[model samples]
Target: MSTVVNQTTPHRSGSVAVIGRPNVGKSTLTNALVGAKISIVSNRPQTTRHRLLGIATFAAGKDAPAGQIALVDTPGLHRQQGKFSASAMSKVMNRAARGALEGVDAAMLVIEAGRWDDEDTLAYNVLSDAGIPVLLIVNKIDRLRDKSALLPFLAQVSQGRTFAGVHPVSALKRNGLDALVKELLMLLPEAPPMFGEDEITDRSERFLAGELVREQLMRQLGAELPYATTVEIERFAEDTSLKQGELLRIGAVIWVERESQKAIVIGKGGARLKEIGSKSRLQMERLFGRKVFLETWVRVREGWSDDETALKAFGYE
Candidate 1:
C-alpha cells in the first residue's frame, strides 16, 4: 500500500477595515480577533491616533476555515465637535479612518449593542460609502440585562441598511466570534495569507512602545488632558550586556500642549509620572515578552495637536 499525504491551502485572506465611533470597542474587537493587544485600549474617546494593522490568522478549525485577516485598525470616525474634534489632530484621525477603507475587501462597522446614535450612523455611512461589503458587528452584547431585547436591537439597526452579515458579539468576553469569523471568511475570495501565521501586527516594537505609553497617559491623566497628549519614543535600543536576558531600553516623551498640563502629569512629587512609567513598562514587557527599562518625561509642545508640522514630528498619522 502507498502512503498518502494531504495538504490544505487557506481558502480566504484579505484586508478588513474596523471603523466606528469613538469608545465603541473597535480596538478591543481588533485585539480580540487578533489574539493580541497590538492596539491599545482606554476609556477615553480617540485613544487611537494612528492607523495600525493587526494580523489575525485562524487555522482551519472545525467551524471555521483556514485564513488570514489583515485587520486595518484605524481611529474612530465621528462628526467633528467639542474640543478634541476641533483640532488638526481630529482631522488627522478622521482622515486616517477614511483613508483606511481604500483597497480593502470588507469593513466591520462595530457598535455597542442596543445603541445606534448619530455617530453610529455616521460610521455606517462612511463604511457604506466605501463600496465594500460591510459586516455589522453588534459588540458589547454581554452587557445587556435583557437578552431578549437583543433581537429587537439588531432588527432596529439592520433596517434600511445593506449589511452583508450581522453578528452579535461581546468582544470583551470573546463570545460569538467563531461564527463571525466563519461568515467573514466566506465573503472573501480564495487567496493566500497576507502575512506570516506567527505575525500578529505590522507595527514595529518602537511604535508599539510609544502607543503603550500613550495608553497609560490616556488612562491615568485627567479627562481633558489625555486628549492633548501624545507619546513619542525618543529612544529604543536593546541592551544585551546583562546575563539575565536581553533588555529593551526605551525613552518616551509625553508631549502636552501647555505647561500646566505638564505639571499635572508629573503629579505631586513625580508620583504620577512614576506610576505611568511603571505601568507602561509592565505592559511592554508582557506584550514583547522581554524585560524593559522605560524612562519617561513630560514636556510641553505648545499647540502640537493643532500644528501640522508638530503633529508630523510627534508621529501622529
Candidate 2:
C-alpha cells in the first residue's frame, strides 16, 4: 500500500536569529536576503549593537508555500574580560543578542568562509544549545581563491552539529542566496505572513539615519575612530509644506567618549565632519527617496561607552 502525504498548508512565517562572531558578514547576509540595507556594515568588529530585524517575504511557487522569514541581525558573540571600558557595552550587546535568539523558531549561525575561530565556537555553542533548528551560513565565499576548498571546510564544520542545512554564500555578490533562502523557507514554521510583502525592515527612518551617519564615520575615519564614535538623531522633521526640493530636515550629534576623539572626528578645519555629513545626507536622501537637509554636531560624552546609565540613554541598552 502506498502512503499519502498532505499538502494543504500554503504559508510559512517565523523568526530566525542571525548570530555570529564579529565581522563575519551577518549584517551583509541580512541585507542581501531582505534586498535592502537594513543593518549597517563595517569592517570593524562588534559594529552591530542592536537586535535588528529584516523581514524577507518569499512568494509561493508551484512546489512550496509562501513564507516570511524575520531575520534578526544581532551583535557578535565574543569573550570579554576585565573591567575595561568596552566591557559594559559588550555585556549589554551580548544580552541583546541572547534575547534575540530566545523564542525564535530557527537560527542562522553566520561564519566567515574557510575560517573558524574561538568566537565562532562560542557562537556555535550558544546556537546549538538553543534546541532550535540551526542553519549554518558560511558567508564571504567569494573571498576564497580556491573554490574546491569549500566542501571540506563545510564538512569539517558540520561534523557534530545538528544543523538543518548548510549553505555557502557570498552575500556581497548575491551568490547562492536563492538556494539558501529556499532552505530557510523550508525550515520556517507554517503560519500567516507576519508583515506586508513590500515591507523590508522593522527599523524606523530615524534609526536608519543615525546608522547611516555612523557608517560613513566608520568608513571615512577607518581605524582612528570606529570604536569611539556613536551617532544620535537629535531631531528628524518632515516638511509637509511641499516647498521646493527639501522634504526632510535631520539634526544629529556624533558622540565621542572623550574631547580628543571629538577633535579627531571634526578633523582639520571641520572638513572631515563636513565630508561625513555630506555622505550621510546623500545616503539619507536615497533611503527616504526625498531631499534631505542634514546637520551634524560632534560632542564629547565622557565615558559613555562604559557608563551603564549613559549607554542606556544612548539606546545601546
Candidate 3:
C-alpha cells in the first residue's frame, strides 16, 4: 500500500501582542483565547521568557469577525539594565517584546486594576514606541468589589493617549472576557482560518510540557527558584502498554544558575525535587491524558540567560 500525505492551507491571520508587566494575566489571556494552556501562567513576575503564539480559530462564533485571531503572549516589560540586575536575562525579554510588536495588526496592553505603577507606564511606552494600535486591557477587575473604582484609572489612562478601546476584564475570573473578545474580533483583520478546525494552539506538546513544569516550579519554589531555573525536555517517548494499556515516559533536565540554588530546589533529602516532580507529572498527565512518568534533574549553567548558544538551544532565537 502507498502512503498518503495531507496538506493544510495556512490561513492568513493577523497577530496581536499581549504586553504587560509581570503577573498581570497576559499568559492567562493567551491560554483563554487558545482554549488550552498555550502559555504557562503563574503568580511570579516575568514568568514568560519567550514570545508564544496561540491560534484562535473562529469559523463562526458570536464574536467571530471575518475569521480567526492569533494571540501572541510576550514577556513582561521592566527595567533590567541596572544594579538590580537581570538585564542579561532581559535580552530574552526584549526579544519577546520585539517579536510581538513587529508585524502585528493590533496589540493588547494588560494591566492590574488595583495597582498601576511605573512598570505599567513603561509597558505602554514600549508599545507606543512600536507604532502599533493597542487595546487597553484592565485585567483583574474581579479583585475590586466596587468595580467603579476602576473608572478613575481607566479615564486617566485613556486621557493620556488614544487607545482602540478600554476594556475592564478579569482573565482569572473569566469575567468580561466576552466583551474583550468581541472588541478583539472587531479590531482583527478580516482573514481566513489560520489553522485546522481542531487546532487550538501553535506550541508543541513538548514545549507546553516544559512550560507546565516551569510554572509548577515557580508555584512551589516561589519567585527565587523559578527565575533561576530553566527546563529542557531531553527525551520524550510514547509507548503503548505491554497489554491493552497506554502511558508515556517523559525525561527532562531542569537547569539552574548555581549549585546552591540546586540544593534549595532539591531540598533536604530531595523532598522539594520530589514534590516538584509529583505536581508536574499530574499536570502533564492531565494535559496528555495518559500515564506520564516524568524525571527531573538539576544542572548548573553560569549566565545561561546571556549565553547566545544557550539561548539558541532553548529556542529563544
Candidate 4:
C-alpha cells in the first residue's frame, strides 16, 4: 500500500528541509535539485553550517501546476561537548544546526547508503518530535557494491514512522533524481511559483562566489584544511573598460583558523594560494559568464568556528 499524503489537490508548493547526519551528501543533493551550485560540497563532515536554499521549479506535474518548492539544506546535527562561545555568529550556524525541522512543511531524512547508526536515530527522533512529514533519502548508493544491503536498513528507519516515500539516490552521479523530484512535487501543495522560473536559489551572487572559492579550496586541500577555512568576496565588478565584452574583477579573502593553517593555505612562497585563486577564478567565469580576474588574500582568524562574532562575519550566524 502507498503512504498517505496530506495534499491531494494538484499544484502544491512549500518548503522542505533536508536534514541528515554529517557527510551524508545534503549539500550535493541540494545542488542537484536546483540544477545549480547553490551549496558547497566537501568530503569533510560538518562542512555545511548554514541553511542553504535551493529553489526547485515544477511545471505541469501529475498533481500540481507549475510552481517552485524551496529546499532548505540544513546543517548536520551533532552532539557537541566543551564550552561554546555565545555571541552573534554562534547564533546563526548554530541556530541552523539545532533547528533543522523548524518552519519546514516536510523533511527529507538523508542517510548514508551503507552506514546507519545512533546519530540517524537521534535525527529522526528530533524530526518526529517536530511533526513534519519525512521522506527517507538513501544517498551515496553508488558507493555501495551490494545494493541489497540497504533494504533492511531502510525498513528499520521507516518502522513506526509516517514516511511520504523512500528513494535511493546518488547525488554525485545524478542518479534517481528525476523520480525523487517527481515524488517531491506530488507531495507539495499546488500554488503559483513563489520565485521566478529563472531563479535558481535565494542566495546572493557575492555569497555564492565566496562559496565557490571555498569549494575549490575544500576540493584541493582535502579533509584536513576544508574544515578550517572560510571565504568572503570583498568586491565583484565588471570592468568598465570592456563595455561590449564580458570581463569581471573579483577580490576575496580566505580566512584560516590559525597562522600555521594560513601558511599552509598560502603554500611555499604563495604557490598554493595562486593555484587556489586560479581555479576559483575559472569557476567564477563559468558562473558569471565572463572573464574573471580574481585576487585572494589569506588571513588568520583564531577560533572563528567557535567564536560567535567571527562566525557572524563569515555568515555562519
- lDDT on C-alpha atoms for all candidate structures: 0.88, 0.86, 0.77, 0.78
Residues 1-317 of candidate 1: C-alpha lDDT, one tens digit per residue: 01122145446899999999989899999999999899999989888889999998877765556788899999999898888688998999999999999999999999999889999999998887789999999999999899999999899889899999999999999998888888888777799887888999989999999999889889987485867888889899888677545799999999888899998899999999999999999999999999999999988878888988888888777
Error of 3 at 279 (Å): 0.9
| Clashing residue pairs in candidate 3 (N, C-alpha, C atoms within 3 angstroms) | none
Q: Per-residue lDDT for 63-182 in model 4, tens only?
A: 334446799998776644323324333346546855756776788999999777877877777777888678889999999998787788778767787778999999999998877877
The candidate that achieves the highest lDDT relative to the unseen native structure: 1
TM-score of each: 0.95, 0.93, 0.89, 0.89
Better of 2 and 3 by TM-score: 2
lDDT of 3 by residue, 1-317 (tens): 01122133222367788998888999888877777777877787778888888887553343234346788888888766663245456766766676788888899999988678898888888888988789999888888887677888787778868788888887877777767776777776656666775776777888878888888788888656656788899877776554333777788788887889889889999999899889989988887777888989988998787677887787774
The ten-residue window of minimal lDDT in model 2 covers 1-10
What residue runs in model 2 are displaced by over 4 Å at the alpha carbon? 1-9, 82-86, 243-246
For model 2, state the Cα shift of residue 138 in Å.
0.7
Count clashes in each candidate, considering only residues at least 3 apart in sequence or on different chains.
0, 0, 0, 11
Estimate the Cα RMSD of every predicted model relative to the unseen true structure. Answer: 3.5, 4.3, 5.8, 4.3
Q: Regarding lDDT, does 1 or 2 come out ahead?
A: 1
Error of 4 at 165 (Å): 1.4
lDDT per residue as tens, model 2, 105-126:
9999999999998888989999
Question: How does candidate 4 fare on TM-score?
Answer: 0.89
* Candidate 4 Cα lDDT to native: 0.78
